[model samples]
Target: MAFKPQSDSDGALSEINVTPLVDVMLVLVIILLVTAPLLTQSVHVTLPKTASTSANIDAQPLQLGIDALGVITLNKQPVINLLALEATLKAEFTKNKDVGVHLYADQAVVYKKVAEVMATVQQAGIAKMAFVTVEE
Candidate 1:
């Protein structure tokens, strides 16, 4: 590169020297294009197919929880009363007949509260119910 002062008759440079910037940008674009396909290369996978579709994929399970204070929740949303819980359950069942409810009751919660909630779930015509438990 040679040092050369560029100026007009007024001794002021009027135009910017953007040739180097354009060259650098073009080089970067070429590098990206060459490496893009290599970055996207992934192993070909053949996933095993099962006879029955997973419930988690088909429909999300509704979560029902009863705290030690006997407060009820459906899908983590608070329910004011058994009637409200029942209504929500009915709506869920109507939306997807195969939808299941996973009930989690705090150990300190009274059995009566849990029973009442179960009865209300039954009344809502939900046949598929599972008790969620922790491992050890």
Candidate 2:
């Protein structure tokens, strides 16, 4: 008579061999979970531009405003005249690349005044231009 184990007499797999597969799947799941956020992460910021739908896309914008008194304001700082304004703008564009300037003229301001400001901005090598207007 040969000696035999009692559990093997049933001729069935009493223990499962799934630990390796489970470990590999768990490792893959952990790797995906760790890297999911990084895959879609990005930086969001607004450089500046016009509200007009007709205006072209711009990356950076400089604000130029003329009040009812015909005073020129660059980014809200008052300037004496177009020459000083041009010098200041040129210096600004030198530091920032691909510059766009937006002109906000008061409704009471003359068309010639707005044109003059645009002229200076153009001379300073600022390529893009836009006009600011109220909706009403």
Candidate 3:
């Protein structure tokens, strides 16, 4: 490298000195190339394989709805009371151990009624339950 002094009469230097920039970019590129292969390297192992079976994908969840008036319905059909609901749920549970219920309660329904319904469901030996809500 050579040094030059600027005279008062000389115009300002507008050209950029990109030699250092080019040097830095080349160094970065070389580092990336060296690390790229290392990043892709992984340990290989022999994996064991077992017999595959299909799940019961056809099983559908039961839809239990409670209207604003606190009337309970199972699968769109009206139920006389919580006892009937529990009987129905017990039967369904017997049919499918993995049975689930999607509970849809009206917003205006009383919390006590909902709690009663949940208790009935729990007593029926059903473990999986989901609350159905409308998206805003």
Winning model by TM-score: 3
Candidate 3 structure quality by residue, lDDT tens digits, 59-130? 899999999999999999999999899999999999999999999999999999999999999999999999
Local lDDT at 71 for model 3: 95
* RMSD in order of candidates: 12.1, 15.2, 2.8
Candidate 2, residues 1-136, lDDT tens digits: the string is 8966577367766888999999999999999999998999988988798686764464458889998989999988999888999999899889875778888889899999988988999899888788878787
Candidate 1 — worst ten consecutive residues by lDDT sum? 4-13
Per-model CA lDDT versus the true structure: 0.91, 0.87, 0.95
Estimate, for each residue in 27-131, the C-alpha lDDT of model 1 and write its tens digit: 999999999999999999999997985545869889999999999998788999999999888998899888888999999999999999999999999989999
Which candidate comes out best when scored by lDDT?
Answer: 3
Order of candidates by lDDT, top first? 3, 1, 2
- Predictions ranked by TM-score, top down? 3, 1, 2
Clashes of each: 0, 0, 0
- The 10-residue segment with the lowest total lDDT in model 3: 3-12
Candidate 2: residue pairs that collide: none
Error of 1 at 136 (Å): 1.6
Cα error, residue 61 of model 3, in Å, equals 0.7
